[model samples]
Target: MPNDKGRRRRFGSVRKLPSGRFQARYRGPDGLMRTADNTFATQTDADRWLVKQEAKILDGDWTNPDVKIAFGDFAEDWFKDRDYAATTRERNAVVLNRFILPTFSDLPLREITTPQVRRWRTDLIEAGVGAASVAKAYQVLRAILHTAVDDGLIERNPCRIKGAGSVTHTERPFLSVPEVYRLADAVPPHCRALILLAAFCALRFGELAALQRHDIDLEAHTVSVRRAYAETRAEGLIVKAPKSAAGVRTVAFPASLAEELAHHLAEYADAGRTGLVFVGARGGVMRRNNFRRIWLRALAATGLGDVHFHDLRHTGNTLAATGGASTRELMHRMGHSSVRAALIYQHLVNGRDHVIADYVDGQIRKVKRPPHGPSGT
Candidate 1:
């Protein structure tokens, strides 16, 4: 038997198992026993593993469980522990089941090497998975491994290996001004005001869909972004608070726009505080798919080839940028988490720098430059 010090150490020792396979055993932070096998073909391999295990013991990082558990199993445990939204949880579970689990399910959590992760990432890219989706999957794996590390299941998170973040994707798409007007003309008259408010006020689709009669103040010309609609795999449609605390804000509307919304509320809204501002003809929450069909019909009528309804929010940002709104102002209006998002909208506006140049030119022209002194002089 090893000395008492070695036995008491968190990462205990390398010893031969009954089947003659050398193994390293340790006690994890969770107070559970764990073991890692040294399936070396040669004594050199066994020696190397012994050295590593001793070093890990000194560094206080070793915690390899003895029983071989699949990466998929560990990932599931990690997922269950997270306090994610119902919809988010379901979506993450689906992605894991569909994309991640099948590939690494049988592999031991501790045995998953950086090369394997890299190869998996490469395979995902080759299989036409978008970089964003792959990145999200990577995040999920990283999070799982991080929890494992915290639980003392492993010395470190293998998912945090270098070169695990090289994925890239195109930016989110938005719409143009004319496209916005065309989209407005496409939606039904009852929904037109809501659509305009969405595009012009930069309200998210969920926020617009969940808007109640009391949330808007026509006299004050403001709309409060208090709640949003969300759909979960388990619970279906549900109303929830804004995505972030900062998302709860009161947005000032233009006078004309306020009047338009006021007129809409009086004519279409039901006689109750909880009445939805924009609902289906039968007076229920607006379904994205159903609204999408109506939106497509409207786009066709306006002769626009193809555009997403979400693009209208981009149109709102573009319109704000064109109207000389500063990035900070735009961010506030759009409820963006970062100014970088607001900058994308700035690029869509025409004559942006030209307008500044024109202003500079007017100022420079005011100071006639001494009639351009004679060339000889």
Candidate 2:
């Protein structure tokens, strides 16, 4: 049969419609002729479209053009089908509602383009969002789009901006040994061991908050971390397993702190074996906001400037590095799943290196004076 160009065509046909627009049609793998989604301005344009459709079908990348899936529906299903912890679920939902969905929710999966992704990230940064928050939002968006690509809803993911999802880590402060103890003493009598354990044991605030009388072994000088309390405004405190398997291991504290730990439990802890090790002023479950008030007062009393509760754990990790703890040991102590974070602490092992250098220098001096040194006896 003659094509709309008034010539014989090989495998597909292009015809000029009554409206004078060129329509492309080709036999799909199902042996049914499929029309292009959009009409072209010219017959050659329609022919080019038909060639692409044939290429896609032959390449096994054929997708039904009739099915139009919106991004919002797909992304919500993606979020629901996964097995996420309660805290992670809450965070993903927040990220979707606040950052991801507002931009691409109603759009078709195939319609999301690289330019749109780049512009969306730029708008977020221009809108005064923090770099870390924007990075998190970008990561969530990239993850959802990646699922779309894998599902064959989109040919490729649109989130391809280099370094768009990475945030530079700012250095956080860690207190010295004396500073940790001073801050501990500045807090209430009940909170002394809290400070000591935080700075020495390297337990996260969440892990520390979830600690119970049974989790501590004064005799072993070890604290078992099994669960952690993850709290969000939408969801109150959620007791969940540690984020990683490494987080579930036991951490040994300095033997010197065992007495203080025992004393804290005896004097202030709840009456039962499973009682919360750290409780609120009224002996109820402790929340971060409530404990933060105490932390601030202690900081003020010690004249320490703006210390976050998390910094105590960082301090402990630095101290571990100073003791020449290996990367694996730091990972275990920090409850980190990877050596990257542990390596940061190793880089901060200034004290141990100095001691080694001094010891080596002393040994060298003791080695029969280097070939007629002027000041040597």
Q: Which candidate leads in lDDT?
A: 2
Residue 375 in model 1: lDDT: 26
> lDDT scores for all predictions?
0.68, 0.77
In terms of lDDT, the poorest run of 10 residues in model 1 is: 368-377
Query: Under the 3 Å rule for N, CA and C atoms, how many clashes does model 1 have?
Result: 5
TM match of model 1 to true structure: 0.72
Question: TM-score for all predictions?
Answer: 0.72, 0.80
Candidate 2 regions exceeding 4 Å error are 1-25, 30-32, 35-60, 338-377
The reply for model 1, stretches above 4 Å from the true place, is: 1-60, 160-167, 171-173, 176-178, 324-328, 337-377
Mind giving the per-residue lDDT tens digits that candidate 2 earns over 1-377? Answer: 24455444686888878787887778877778888879998888887887877787788878886678998999889988978888788887887899889989999888889999999999999999899889999998899889888777788899999998899988999887768867876888767778877888788888887899999987766788889988877778889888886687666666556667777888878878899998878887777888889998888888999789999989887777766666666776777876444443453354433332233233324433332112211
CA-RMSD of model 2? 9.6
